[model samples]
Target: MTITCQEILKTHEHLWQEATVHPFLDGCKQGTITPEQFNTWLVQDYQFVVEFTRMLARILSVAPRHHFDVLLGGLTALKDELNWFQVKAAERNLSLDVSKQRTCEEYSQFLESFARTPYAVQATGLWAVELAYNQGWQLPGHIPEPYTEFADRWGNLGFTDYVKLLEQQADEMLGNASPDIQKEAEETVITVAQFEKAFWQMAFNAT
Candidate 1:
């Protein structure tokens, strides 16, 4: 049986589960995560998002002409997301001036490595990163106060739909790719999943 890109991704669903259902997310859901830890995550994530926005722009630059609108939408969302992070950090008295944690830095490096890759590879990495967050917060349960906004930011139906669109775009791009490119895209997805897990663990441990 031929494996679709989505099916290839499903093979690594365990990593997604490990990332999204992590203890940190559990703490957010139950309001048990300490203020310091939450702040740490916010600061580190803000840094990551800054790099993430750059990554999006990089991808947008190389995106096929037909895919410009979708990629541009993502870039616009990142700009808005960055603004939200700044406002929320101020409201919570958390400084956004903090440095990126080791995990975040490494993830940024991983993203940078895709700078010159094919569209399929880039889309696969981007899709994996977004899907991890969408699935993580969309986990079935009542999201507690404070964290509710955070959950809605990434886990809402609108975002979920957006992710699905990106997934489809990736699959379509991969459809005509060479076998070697397809394998590279799969590796990118797996690496993204692992990085996502590490990112959450970094937040949980406040390391």
Candidate 2:
């Protein structure tokens, strides 16, 4: 499965497309989600997000110094999201329980393990995350009610803001990469799109 970065990206694409795009669009249309529900979702899902970011950070640590900066930038964005999460929690007057860590999906476990492996392996995982973050901005448009709590909570700022930054970093990295590495990163983007779908599926179906 880890034969080449391109192969891994291809492996991850289809599942990703299906899982994320539909429900996200639906949620945006319904606009019934409340700030409190959004907070509960974040609090329940926080561990997966943090772990996911950590895995991406580990992958960034392995890139060539120039390329490494892009990954580092992505990590910074992830941290920014955490800050947003904290602020949102405070806004809603919700207490984040440190003891009740969220359960991770199997795919999340795979990402954490991939981050601990050789550089190439970790890089593949990083690509998935980077690609997803970069491309996810396109889906929010599908959301219908812009004024509802769901829209206010998710449809407004955080995801798109983070995505633009992620895309810019990806563009920089792609522009600077050597031919071989560039090919790998391209493949990584495709893989990430697939993973994005899987992540959404995990979220939608989570108990």
Candidate 3:
């Protein structure tokens, strides 16, 4: 079924809320993570994101012409995160290539599966990605001290623009959607969110 943008946003909101409870965030904020561990996590995250982005691009290919601008814009904004990942890799003296690092196998598999799947699956996959990335911005300020480091790292000035762009896209998609399209979008959002959380859980279990 074709998914609407609004449904995608709602599903993302739910996913972000769930992410707040993830142990990965807890571990980051708790300072339980060594630099090495953080590097490993970053590499795995990049691997997942790279594959997800390709999948999103494919889905965007078939997006409604009316919704195309916002959807593509959102995708473009997210590409900046790749630079962040590269920087993190440099700091850790690690390679950005997934094959080079001991990347999380489950996350890698999820990305590949999401990318290779039919366009019908794009809505769910994209929704999960949007929820996770955007939620990174909306997180509460009360994050534990250990995780606080990432607040600045992931929540930089440029990231604010990214958040605004994403929120705006979500608003536009939801606001302009027909009732039927909205429902489909929401379902996609929820499905994607489930995948988003599962991806992290997969990573956490990996460690």
Q: Once superposed on the true structure, which residue ranges of model 3 sit more than 4 Å away at CA?
A: 1-17, 99-125, 142-149, 152-191, 202-207
List where candidate 1 sits over 4 angstroms from the true fold: 1-3
What C-alpha lDDT does candidate 1 achieve relative to the native structure?
Answer: 0.85
Tens-digit per-residue lDDT, 1-207, candidate 1: 223567876787786678677888888988888888887888888999999899989998888888888888888899899999999999998878877888999999998998978988898888889988998888946688888898899999989988988888898888878888888888888888888888877866645
- When summed lDDT is taken over every stretch of 10 residues in candidate 2, the lowest stretch is 1-10
What lDDT would each prediction earn against the true structure? 0.85, 0.54, 0.57
Off by over 4 Å in 2: 1-13, 34-37, 98-105, 140-198, 201-207
Clashing pairs in 2: 12-194, 16-194, 16-197, 28-144, 128-192
* Tens-digit per-residue lDDT, 1-207, candidate 3: 434454455446656467545655555656565655666667777776776677667667766676576667757755876777787688778887655233345544555565454443444445445546545533644456544555665555655565455455555555665666556545545655565565545444444
RMSD for all candidates, in order, please. Answer: 1.4, 5.9, 5.2
Clashing pairs in 1: none
Q: What TM-score does structure 2 among the candidates reach?
A: 0.61
lDDT of 2 at 149: 43
